[model samples]
Each structure stands twice: as C-alpha cells, then as structure tokens.
Target: MPPVWDPAEAPVGDVGAALLMVDARIKEIHEPEDESEDGAEAERGELNRLFVASAGAEGVQELLDGTCTLLYMFMQWLRRTHEHGDKDVIEYVVPPLVATLRMMPRSVRPQTVPTMVALVVAAGTQVSPNGWRSQYGDWTPEEMNALEATVFLVAEHINRIAGDHNFAVRMIAETLTRVETDGD
Candidate 1:
C-alpha cells in the first residue's frame, strides 16, 4: 500500500502548500516500509503517476514563484549580512550563494552583481579575529581563502552581467563613485 499523504510535511509560508503536496506525493510513492522487491516496482509506478500529477498541478507553479522570491530575498540577506561584517553568516551562506549566482538567469545577472560585490567587500573587511570563529570554528586559512575565491567568482559573474546591460554599467559606476566619495 502507498503511504498516506500528510500536509504537515509541507513547508509553511508562501510555498508551503505546494511543497507539502509534493512531499505528500513523494511519501506516497516511496514509503519507508516499502523495501521489498515488489514494493520497489510499485514505487516506480507511483513515481510515474506522481510526475504526471505534479506536472499538471497548480502547486508546481506556486513552487516556482516561491523559489524565485526566496532566491531574491536570500541575495538581499547576503548583501546585508556582508554590510554588517557578519563573517559567520557569510561562511555558512557561501555555498548556497555561489550556487544561486551561478544558476540565476542572465536577465537578473546585472541586478545581482552589486550585492555580490558588496558581499566580497564585506568579507574582506572583517576586522575581528573572532568574528568568523563561531561559524568556521577550526577552518584552516586555506578554507577561508577558498571562500574568498568564491567571492571572486561572484564578482566575475557580476562583470559578465554588467557587460550585457549599459544601464547596469552606469549604475555600478555611480555606486562605486558614491562609495569612494563617502569613504573620504
């Protein structure tokens, strides 16, 4: 027998209902107790059914919309965290940040560069030896350097995106000028 659906597994919030529905379908198709050979075959059949069902679900559209919104918010958070000199947050968020930067569409690339540059500048400006200690704990200098490399990669991505938009180039230039003048 397939597992019963449970709405509780759905993430609560903007995309919660859709995620929950997907989770319920996944659970129904792959119950923990269904370990037998026959169960495996049944699981495959259930998976196919789930694919078809999900393809037609309004939930999937909601999920996609939610994901895009979350991604934008996450980028904003990263920018703020960097501005606050929160190395701990950067250390924890780097991997996902890099992944998001890499996967974002070219259309959004220009808008994303400033945040990425801000994150790198923030990471480089860490003044407290213990600031990153809580999160990275025992990370070697090499590990920290690797994180810097990721920041550099994001910077390059920003540059690539800026090349595609004249407005982005002007905006970035103006922002850089403001930062430079404000520092004086």
Candidate 2:
C-alpha cells in the first residue's frame, strides 16, 4: 500500500533498467521448455522477487507503471498457458498488483486504462489458442469471443479505477456514429 514511486523525482535510467530486467524474467518464465512443469511455485516466487525489486525503484513513476503492465501480462499469460485448475500463483500475485495499481500517483494514474487495454489485448492475442487473427481462418469463434470478453472485462475494471466508467460505452457510440456516417 506504500507509494510505489514519486512521479516528480526518481532516477529514470536505473528504474527503467530494473523494470526491463523484471520483464525479461517474465519472458523467461513464459518461454516454452524453459521452466519445469513442477516449478510453478518457483515461477511465482521469482515473479514476487521481481515485483519487490521493482518496488525498490520506488519514486520512479514509469518504473511502477512498467511493473504493473508486466504483471498483468504475466497474469493473462498464466491463465492461458497453464492448464492446472489450481491458480495458486495467480491468487498469490494479483492482490499485490492491485495494491500497487491503487498506490500509483494521480499524475500517472490516468495512463492506467490505456496501458491495461494494450497489455490485455497483447496478452490475449499472444495466448490465443489458434492465433491473433480470428477473421483470417485462424482463431475459432469461441476463442475470439473469449478474447473479446477478456479485453472487455479488463477495460471495464481499468476504467472504473481510472474514473472513466463510461469510456468503452462512449467509444462504442462514437465508433457506431463514425460507421454510420461513413467517416464523414
């Protein structure tokens, strides 16, 4: 619950490097043939360690933002890649992430919605069973539907936190209007 970083002042290079390191670790964990099947606990531990290490860059706003984005991507990956019914790793990781998000400074908080959407969409596409393109004879209807639903849910949660509760609704309405007018 402590402030992750003070947006006003923090060493940009050091914090950025720390966040990148954590991201690389996350990538390693997700790599095929990299982590052992029985190492789920170890994977979660490593993620936790990275999370804490990133927190040490406290006061660096972008570092915190990058960390949160990476963690969310990790969650989306965890849900898709793992077949285990037991979600102990997710259960262990998300609360702290949520806490970290809530602790973000107002200056950086507005960016959360877009960041969540981007990461969620990226995660969904990468983890899609068939492929990223549902319209290209790749993804099944069910997979497309699931991906859409996941993106919608993540956006809604982010909008709620970012105080833009009607964001998606407004975006849909705007898009519909644009389509109706043929870009006029």
Clash statistics: count for each candidate: 1, 2
Give the poorly placed runs of model 2, Cα more than 4 Å off: 1-131, 134-137, 182-184
Distance from true location, Cα of 143 in model 1, Å: 29
lDDT of 2 by residue, 1-184 (tens): 1122222221223323333454343344344454447877567668756765675645333443433333344345445433355544334334544454445434234334334344344343333211212223432323322332333344444344446655433443454467669966
- TM per model? 0.26, 0.25
- Top model number, lDDT: 2
Best by TM-score: 1
| Clash list (residue pairs), candidate 1 | 10-20
Candidate 2, residue 181: the lDDT equals: 100
Model 1 stretches astray by more than 4 angstroms: 1-14, 18-57, 86-184
- Return the number of clashes found in candidate 1: 1
